[model samples]
Target: MKTVISLLFIFMVIVGCNSTKNVVTTDTVSKISDTVKIANEELEYEVIIIDPGFSSWIAGRALPRGYYSEAYLENKNQFYVAEWNNRVAQPMQYDSNLYLFRIDYDLTIRYGYEVNYLIYNYFIYFQNRYNQRLGGFVPKQ
Candidate 1:
């Protein structure tokens, strides 16, 4: 219950191969404070999502809670995490910025409904926003 989840999301603006500068636009700045924390005390797991616009996006675009079963979310999350980790490993092939960190999601762990829901939606948001596909089916709300 006391476990602290700390995840950093550094979104860089890639102008060109030569540019190393990180740009923070007005939209980015506004969304900077939009962080969503999902924690299950009984399960002792926590997920913190600091991606810009995710808070608002989830509120407006994501499907309502319980729309999909926890099992479904877990199944989708397992597949998405696998693909995400694969991309993170092969940075040369995938955009390193998009796949910066490898997600540590264990299938054996029962992360409950809220944890799975947030993680699943974040994956959908990520895929849609970045134009990346983690699975065969198109990422949807």
Candidate 2:
């Protein structure tokens, strides 16, 4: 019994030490279906997460009816995934496979970065593929 208890205690200590506590606000929780608020400890800017299910969908779903090749979509998806992972201080803390399921058309775009254009285009592609009329903001390419 003592040996078992010691092993359990050590396991808990290891798990506890590896975990990170995130204090999410009510606003973030309410808008979770539409936006993702990832706290980047290293970066100065906040990433306005629009789609939470993008990574998983990309991993699981087929490519939408479009002129873009499967390789193109796959490459783009990989780019976004890698970029997002690099953005976060602890990549393992968040579920990289998750993507937003709903759309909030009311949220205005702010803190616009050039990379957002790429992300937005991918969002538009996702919307088109899933037939989800989300954020109607389409990209030219």
Candidate 3:
């Protein structure tokens, strides 16, 4: 009788833990879809969050130049600005997002450095990834 009672208690605890996970998952989805607050209240900026499932192909071509926000690299909402003539455009990512664009250019260089860097890096990353899918070999020319 004691063994059966112990099993029942363990099952109940497991079920309770599962239910809490479900609730938190639902809440996160709702917040991502509904929350528009910027990650930093001190920084006055606009946020354009893209859901992770969407196609980010065109968005990759539209990265801004300059130094990017550290928060963005750590899965937070961030918009970065460079003080003109920076070497490469910095890009950041959020876990639930497909692509986010911060498109304000108040710079001196006519050439878009940051945007170019982002496109190049992304291409290289994907190219490397697909190359591995093809059994990691240089095609015999």
Instruction: Kindly give the number of clashing pairs for every candidate.
Output: 0, 8, 2
Q: Against the true structure, candidate 3 has what lDDT?
A: 0.24
Candidate rank order under lDDT: 1, 2, 3
- Which pairs of residues clash in candidate 1, taking residues 3 or more apart in a chain or in different chains? none
lDDT of 2 by residue, 1-141 (tens): 432232221100001112233321222111344443433232222334444454344334534345465445444544544433343334365322323122221112221222233344545545554443333243422
RMSD of 3: 21.0
TM-score of 3: 0.19
The candidate that wins on TM-score is: 1
Off by over 4 Å in 3: 1-30, 34-37, 52-102, 105-141
Look at candidate 2 and tell me the lDDT of residue 102.
20
Model 1: lDDT to the true structure: 0.64
Model 3 lDDT per residue over 1-141, tens place: 432232221100001111111111111111233121122112222222232211243244323434444323212111122211121233332211111222343222121232233323333332333332112232221
The superposed Cα distance between candidate 3 and the true structure at residue 115, in angstroms, equals 17
Off by over 4 Å in 1: 1-7, 10-32, 40-44
Q: What is the Å distance of residue 15 in model 1 from its true position?
A: 34
